[model samples]
Target: MGDLSLVRALGRGNIPVAVTTSERQSKVGFSRYCVAVVPTPSWVDDPEAALAAVIAWSEQQREPPVLFYQGDHDLLAASRGRERMAGHLRCVLPPAELVENLVDKQRFAAFAERRKLPVPLTRTLCRGK
Candidate 1:
C-alpha cells in the first residue's frame, strides 16, 4: 500500500520511478507512473543476489537512481552493500550498524533504552529458558 502510494506521489511529481520487487503479484509494477519494473531476488532469501540485481539494474540507467526500499530486508541489503552500491545507486540510509540494530526488535529496544528515546518499555522473552 505504501509502495503504491509512493509510486503515485513520485509520478505526480514527474519523477521517473522504477520499482524493484521479487513478488510477481506486486501492484507497484502495474502502476502507470512506473517506468520500469526490475525483478530482484528476495533479499530475505539471498541478500547478495538481490543487491546484485539492484546494481545491475542501475548500470542500465543513464545516471545513478535514488533507491527507496520499503522493508527491513531491502534496507539491510542496501545498507550492508552501501560501498558496492555507491556508484551504481543512491540511497539515503542510516549507518549500517544502526540499520541492523533498528531492524531487530530486541536490539532496537536496547538501542532506544540506551538513548532514552521515550519509547515504551520493551521486554524480550526467551524460549525454553
Candidate 2:
C-alpha cells in the first residue's frame, strides 16, 4: 500500500521510481510509475543480503537514485549500509543510534521518556510471561 502511494505521488511529479520488494507478487511492480521492479532478499530474514541487493541494483543504474523507503526494514537496511552506498545511491539516513532507538520499541520508549516526549509507557514481555 505504502509503495503504491509513494510511486503514485512521485509519478505525479514526473519522477521515475524503481521498487525493490521481497515478494514477487507485489502490485507496486505493475504500477505505471514503477520503471523497474527488482527482487531483493528479505530484510526480515537477512538484512545484509537485502542491503547487498540494494547496492548491487543501485550500481547498475545510470545515475545514483534517491533512496526512499516506507518500511522499517527498508529504512534499517538502508541506514546500516549508507556508507557503503555513498557513491552508488543518494539517501538521507538517521544516525545509527537514532535508527536503533526508532526501530526498537523498548529503546524508543526509553528515549521518549528521557526526552519528556508525550509517549505512553511501554513494557517488554519475554516468552512465558
Candidate 3:
C-alpha cells in the first residue's frame, strides 16, 4: 500500500518506478500507474532463499532497477546479499548491521544512548505488579 503511494509520487516527479512482491495477491493493479510489476520470492520462513530469488530475478532485467524493500526481513536479507545484487539493482537501504540495530529495540536504545541521542524511557512490565 505504501509502495503504491510512493510509486505514484515518484511518477508525478517523472521518476521511473517498479513494484516487486512475493505474494500472488495483487495489492495494486497495473493501470498506467507505474512501470512494471516484478514477482520475487516469499520469505515466510527462509529469508535467504527469498533474497537469492530476488537477486537472480533482478539480474535478468535488461536495465538495472531501483529497488525499494518494504519489510524489515526483506531489507536485512537484501543487505546481506547486496554484493551479488548490486550490479543488477540499486537498493535504498542501510547496511545489514544498521538494519539489525534498527529492528532490535534494545540495540536501538543502546545506540541512542551511545550517540547521546534522546530515547524514550521504557520500563519492563511484570505480572501481578
Candidate 4:
C-alpha cells in the first residue's frame, strides 16, 4: 500500500523510480511511474544479498536517489546498513536502536500500553490447537 502511494507521488513529480520485489510479477513495481524493476532475493531467505543488491544499484546511478523504507524489514536493513549505503544513496531510516525497539513485538506492546495507547489483544496459540 505504501509502496504504490509513494511510487505514484514520485511519478507526479517526474522522479525516476525503481523498486525491488520478490519478482517482476509484483503489481506495485509495474506502475506506469516505475522505470526499473529489479527482482530481489527474498528478505527471509537471503537478507545479505538483498542489501547488496540495493547498494549495487545505488552505486551505479550517476546521481544518488532518495531511498525509502517500505516496511520494518526494509527499515531495519537500511538502518543497519546505513553507513555503507549512505555513501552511494540518501538512505532514510530511523536509528538502528529505534527500529530494533519498535520491531520487537513484546517491547512495542508494553510501550504502547504504558503510553495509554490502544493495543490489540494478543494471545500465544499453542501447537496442535
Name the best candidate (by TM-score).
1
TM-score of 4: 0.79
Candidate 2 matches the true fold with a TM-score of 0.90
Writing each residue's lDDT as its tens digit, candidate 1 over 25-71 gives: 78988999998988888879998898899899899889999988888
After the best TM-score superposition of candidate 1, give how far the Cα of residue 60 lies from its true spot, in angstroms. 1.1
Model 2 over residues 23-127: C-alpha lDDT tens digits? 988899999999998788787788878778878898888998888878788788888888888998888887989998999888999999899999877888899
Could you tell me every candidate's TM-score relative to the true structure? 0.92, 0.90, 0.76, 0.79
Model 1 lDDT at residue 1: 14
lDDT of each: 0.87, 0.84, 0.70, 0.76
Candidate 4 lDDT by residue in tens digits, 4-73: 8899998999988898887658887889999987667875577667878877887888887777777777
Ten-residue stretch with the least lDDT total in model 4: 38-47
> How far does residue 23 in candidate 3 sit from its true spot (Å)?
2.3
- How close to the true structure is residue 52 of candidate 2, measured as C-alpha lDDT? 83
Every model's Cα RMSD, please? 1.7, 1.8, 3.0, 3.0
All candidates in order of TM-score, best leading: 1, 2, 4, 3
Candidate 4: the clashing residue pairs are none
